[model samples]
Target: GGPRTQLEYRYVGYAPQTVEVGNRTMIDVSLEQETNELESVVVVGYGEQKKATLTGAVATIDMQDIKTPSPNLSNSLQGKIAGVISVQSSGEPGYDNSTFTIRGIGSFVNTSSNAPLIIVDGVQREDVNSFNTGIFNNIDPEDISSISLLKDASATAVYGAKGANGVLIITTKRGVTGQPRLTIKVESGVTNFTKTPELLNGVDYMTLYNEARRNAGQSETYSPRDILLTRSGLDPYMYPNVDWIDEVYKSFSSVTNAHLNVTGGSEKVRYYVSASFYDQEGQYKVKKMNGYNPNLSYRRYDFR
Candidate 1:
């Protein structure tokens, strides 16, 4: 047996356990907690129940379910969640969030129609009608932990009249019991016009116009010499052959997204914090005046 007075066992937030004069082979010790602390628990508007036992029509999705490069969280929800009808009115960077509905439109009133109640961390967010940033929709997708869609009345009874349309609950990531963990994610890509209208330059336009005139039994409007001059690009002022699309558009625009996060905590204090950035360049090629170019871009930064 070893001496009992020379050893001490200490654990943070818990009372120390001392093994005094043990058998030297095996010992059992239970360390009591010095302080009580709150732990993580799942709580819906009402109470939580197993999926098999759930009575209301509620849908849930985890981070893996709606993961995408899109900064707009709503954009990634389309086609991924059941009973969710997601529609995007525009593809513009900041305006790309989908205007979604749960179980389709429930009201015919224009102002209140089709808009589901958005709740983040148990607080209701304002209903948004415009393309501007939606409080819940603009949340960093990586910062989100889970989302729930309360489709039927039974599941959303607690929300009362506000839940007439439906309810969407978003919960952000929080700290867990572990050592501090750092994570970094980066994404970069380009976007190009999928399709564009075919247009004719000066020479082709004149040739086609002259052919049409000839088919109508009329004289040629543009002389062959003028057409040749336009094709030769000799005098842009008098016979300009300009392709506006080639002038207005570039090959592609850039899109970038990044996220960095750290999560760590002791049993009594757990925390999750993250920062993210999203930037999208416009497709239009703007001309520079002097040395400065007025380029178009959309940028969003999020910290949680």
Candidate 2:
């Protein structure tokens, strides 16, 4: 026989005990428990549903697999999702928005409308075609909690006209009923050309050209001695055995990203705030007359 007090804690473990005393009672408690997978909620066209009950063709992206440093979410989604094809057309600093397709090309009549609709926090955004660069640059990757892609018609039918291509639902992180927590993440890396074309040098070019001329029943413009001089690396100014690929392209470029996030609150009201900074230096090297070399670079700061 004893007095007992019961308390409820969310996402936490607890131990209960009973105590008894003459006319007065007190219960000492200790906590130790682990939480496991709960039901997952997914957002669809106009409402939300449990992932287990959803009948549409949907795929959830695992944020853990997106380890590459990218300026936009599109770049990180490359090859990470099923039936999605992402192509980065250009490596230009801020303009590096990747072109992505859901399933496959739907129609050739209107190539411009092939892009999927982007919905952030249940609001439809403007078509990305209107923006010259990646419209998602303002979004910090750390702030994203989950990304749900709706592919089939039954899944995207709610949008009516805009549902022809598909739909991409982006969900941001929200504070939970817990102690205030702060997280800081920093990443830095380098980018370089994976492969470059192998072009013929000046001597090889001259030899090939002379061979072609001889095949056409014409005299060889470059003599064997001339070819030897070009191959021997003598008087480059005159022979001009230039490797244009090396002259134009750089070996590598640098990239850096940093993010800070704070989240916490009570069950009634929660808050999440984040700030991020990203910088990427392009591989293009421009030579200036005054002994200066400038490389294309991009810097962006984001707050949410």
Candidate 3:
């Protein structure tokens, strides 16, 4: 024996390999390692921190969880985050920004400050509401990569006064090192009311009204003949029984959305481009004097 030789080497990676040769063994070995979930980095107020090291309360919204179509990005956050309440105050065309509150209502004194601070790409915005008319639309949801809600004082203290109501950090998608990729998505559908109130017809409405009037010690406004005339579709011009609810609401409204995205880049330079169009028609149809009926329609064009 050549003075007993021993050698050892250690490496951390996937799989393990070993080889021995002659008396002086030469060995090659590899060790597998597990990923530490705590090491995952998350966007915080002013900076990023590892999830495991963060002591503040935070909640992340999964983009996949947003399946419904919405005019404003805030509307998509409904029921997606825990301890966060998102409410669409109105569905009016181009003015549908959902109100969001973190950890419940923090202040009733100032309604303006009740909303969480929205930070997009490190820039702070008062709220997602759009004032320029048209369904409070701002920021295309397709461009969003991640949304993190910063709760608790520890995480929001970095933002000073702005963070008192909490903070929402929105990160847009970035190009990665790979071949150029193009994605086009098209969605078209109709929206119908989930539930409609049971309404009375002309005769039934008159009957109920007359009964109520009689109970209140008043004379009946509609006679039996009047009810029959309104019910029969013949004297509409004189004794009209309009179904206001049916006339105001449609059976279904159309919605169409299309988005195109292109992304590619190298280590030095990366780029992401996206274009989208959204068109939605409201259920309410208004007839113009020019014999044209137009539904409350909203159209939005987005480019990034």
Residue-pair clashes per prediction, in order, are 2, 0, 7
TM-score of each: 0.80, 0.75, 0.78
User: After superposition, which runs of candidate 2 have C-alpha atoms over 4 Å from their true positions?
Assistant: 1-38, 108-110, 128-133, 228-234, 287-294
Worst 10 residues of 3 by lDDT: 128-137
lDDT of 2 by residue, 177-248 (tens): 789899999999899887889899888899899999999999999999899989888778877788888887
Sort the predicted structures by TM-score, highest score first.
1, 3, 2
- The global C-alpha lDDT for each of the candidates, from Candidate 1 onward, is 0.77, 0.76, 0.76
Residue 212: error of model 1 in Å? 1.9
- State candidate 2's TM-score: 0.75
The stretch of ten residues in a row with the least summed lDDT in candidate 1 is: 35-44
Q: Model 2 residue 209 lDDT?
A: 100
Worst 10 residues of 2 by lDDT: 11-20
How well is each residue in 216-299 modelled by candidate 1, as lDDT tens digits?
Answer: 999999999999999998899998988889899878999999999999999999989899888999888987699876666779
lDDT of 2: 0.76
Candidate 3 structure quality by residue, lDDT tens digits, 1-304: 3535444444532333444444654455565553455566788876788776778998877778764677767778888888877667667776766776666655423255676777888887665433442322457788888889988898899888888878889998999778999999889988777788888888888899999999999999999899888889797999887878898998988889888999999999999999999988888867666766566678889888
